[model samples]
Target: MNYETFENRVLPVKNKLFRFAFRLLGSSEEAKDVVQEVMIKVWNGREQMATIENMEAWCMRITKNLSLDRLRSNQRRATDSLTEGFEIRQETLTPHERTEIHENMQRVNEMIAALPEKQRQVIHLRDVEGYSYNEICEILELDMNQVKVNLFRARTTVREKLVKINAYGL
Candidate 1:
């Protein structure tokens, strides 16, 4: 793929890739590094990338592998803090709405953080990143049935937790 084509088609997905990496690595700096590495690899492999059936999936697969590698390498460092440097965008919401959304997002993020790695990945790809099942299966290298099962389980778990929290007025 040409640089122009890559910029037009692939660069738009960078934020999603970075968010996925951030969620997995829990560090903005590491996530940024991962995204740069992923993009560099993609640019170097652009000739072969055109032959790939699904570019987004292929890119995500690369991102996931690289992020995992970074995570493993960084395990020897200080433990990851629960509070990463990620900030919620505040441009659009009114003060009251922003506070409410922030509170809800915090709770949801906590719930997601408690999920198993596979489930959290699936839910994030599907719900947060808006990836289709086929694309997620491709990125994760899982069968269709397995993707469906994991997504269903993850959604169910989140729903149940939310229900219980509401019931308890938490």
Candidate 2:
């Protein structure tokens, strides 16, 4: 692909790709690095890319693999930070509101982190990244049924956890 065409076509997806990487890796800097690496790889393989049926799926697959490799190499559990990009303003909030928001966010993050790897990946692609089932299957190299099952399990697990947390006032 020509540089202009590649930029016009693929560049728009960078933010989405970066967000996917960030959600998976839980580090903004690492996510940015993954996006750069994935883009470079795509650029290098542009000739072969022409033969690929789904460029978005292909790019997502590359991003997921690279992010997983980075995670494995680091040997660290994923930890999401609300303070990923913009610094939290110290503007005072009512104590009640602050506590409620903090608790809810923490609960959500913990539930997501607690999900199984395949389930978490499916959730990230389907929910967070807004990918269709077919695209998610392509990115994850899983069959359609597997993708559906994992996504169902992931959402169900998260919903159950949230219900329990609410019932117990956690």
Candidate 3:
């Protein structure tokens, strides 16, 4: 319950919490605010913190709930969304090649974002964050079967969309 204990145990998961929050809320500022809120909430409830087994997961669950609450409070059907940016080596490829790659990456990102809500959340938690099924279940408050089914359906939808793009050159 002390500041030192909370710092030692819970502070380390800030980045993970930020990423999860950002993934849900899709704005860096909003995500940072959510992470701060999560930290404060955890600190306030520090007396009960030791009862939890996985501190990181617990923090993540709080981040998820807070992020979703923010979304609902805003009453926004859509978020600003995030793009996965990467550096270009500038070695073996021409500007045309780089542009093509960037376009493809953006297309893939749009496809994922277009997925249904539950599918997108499950995909992000499992694929992007690399959380286990049980952890995702806890975070999403879903059963194991529902998590797996959502993940499977999400993957299939992505694959099908990619195939359409590649096959039709669309």
Cα TM-score of candidate 2 = 0.87
- Write model 2 residue lDDT over 83-146, tens digit each, in one string: 4344224558777777667767766877887787889889988888788888898999999999
Candidate 1, 21-82: lDDT as tens digits: 87787777888899999999999998898579888888889989998888777663222454
Tens digits of per-residue lDDT for model 3, 1-170: 78888888889889888877776777788889999999999988988987999888889889989999998898654345455446666769998999888788778877877877789889988888899999999988999999999999999999999899889998
lDDT of each: 0.83, 0.85, 0.85
Clashing pairs in 1: none
Model 2 poorest ten-residue lDDT run: 82-91
Q: Any idea what lDDT model 1 has?
A: 0.83
Model 2 steric clash pairs: none
lDDT of 3: 0.85
**Residue 137 in model 2: lDDT:** 85
* Alpha carbon deviation, residue 94, candidate 2 (Å): 6.3
Candidate 1 ranges beyond 4 A from true positions = 76-97
Q: What is the lDDT of residue 96 in candidate 3?
A: 93
